[model samples]
Target: MKQILKNSPPTRGIDHLAFVTDDLPATMGFYTKVLQMKLVHVRRVPFEMDRGQPPYDNLRHYFFDMGHDQLLAFFEYPQGLDKQNRDLPGGMQHVAFYVPPEKFDDLIENVKAQNVNVIGPVALGGRFWSAYFYDPNGIRLELATTRLSTPGGIVESVYQSEEEARKELETLFDDPETVDYWLSQMPLKHQ
Candidate 1:
């Protein structure tokens, strides 16, 4: 019987997820104090002409241990860049961190205790549940969890019936054939 993660993603997983921050100290404090992530490293991004660096020399790049061998990193620019609307076309809507089901409730309480307004452990189909909140940088975040009983783990937990998937996908396509084709592309839910 499989416990979980039976099928690894093609890229394994993200090495790090990066974002920009205005205040390095405050961002560090919030992530460490609120989320209990540890500060792992701080680098200085050098100004390289046309190299896609943040247009500055020795700007701060901080990394936090986001667990599972992954890092959550932030780059701090001098005087910083202005905040942009998250709803803008190129903006990130949100990022969700995986939380074990056992820890979900306590984490939510801790977030609220820190005076952060959180939305919910809202049901998001199948066993998916998440509580949404924002960091001090206004980066929308979620603590996501799932209740798993199947041997297939997370994959099995999120598995949907072919018929249900078809019904949901149909709305986005012009014809049933297109829907069917895309449906065939969905990763197989292993037994």
Candidate 2:
């Protein structure tokens, strides 16, 4: 753990997550209208399909503000959807955005008002709540909120000693009682 941490490059929050879109207008409308993200920038750049192929002169790149200085960007390219390997078991699965707990329910309703189905308020080991839905581009999106005590709360103690931390993590799944405690704390949606 120590060695891995030492070699890890320092990173701030994600600058943006980029996706490809076949219909730029609908993508722009869904993000800006339904999701309420601001359309911050747009530009066109030359794109090369292959080393030998002629460069495509008009690939449109656009950015949508996902708040807190984060961006969700899209590139409009011909046949971009067809070029993706949709059958891959583990490609880019989903993108999750954090929301304040107080505003979580309102956001869910807002998404529903836009005629999108949402599937959660599911508790993640009592540490957080997350709801999942798909964007107009069929990209899975998650809205999440951290509980009062987050999973990271134990990080300092857990990582205090490398060997001890490793041993605890390794055996963590073996304790059913601890797991039950976490599950028991999950918020009841109906209540």
lDDT of each: 0.83, 0.71
TM-score of 1: 0.86
Clashing pairs in model 1?
none
TM-score of 2: 0.69
lDDT of 2 by residue, 119-188 (tens): 9879785446889998777788889876664444322212333344335545776676554443343322
Tens digits of per-residue lDDT, candidate 1, 102-182, equal: 888998898888888999989886778889989988999999898655424655566677877888898898887787777
Which runs in model 1 stand beyond 4 Å of their true positions? 1-9, 148-152, 188-191
In terms of TM-score, which candidate is strongest? 1
Cα-based lDDT at residue 129, candidate 1? 87
Report how far residue 81 has shifted in candidate 2, in Å.
4.2
How well does each candidate superpose onto the true structure, as a TM-score? 0.86, 0.69
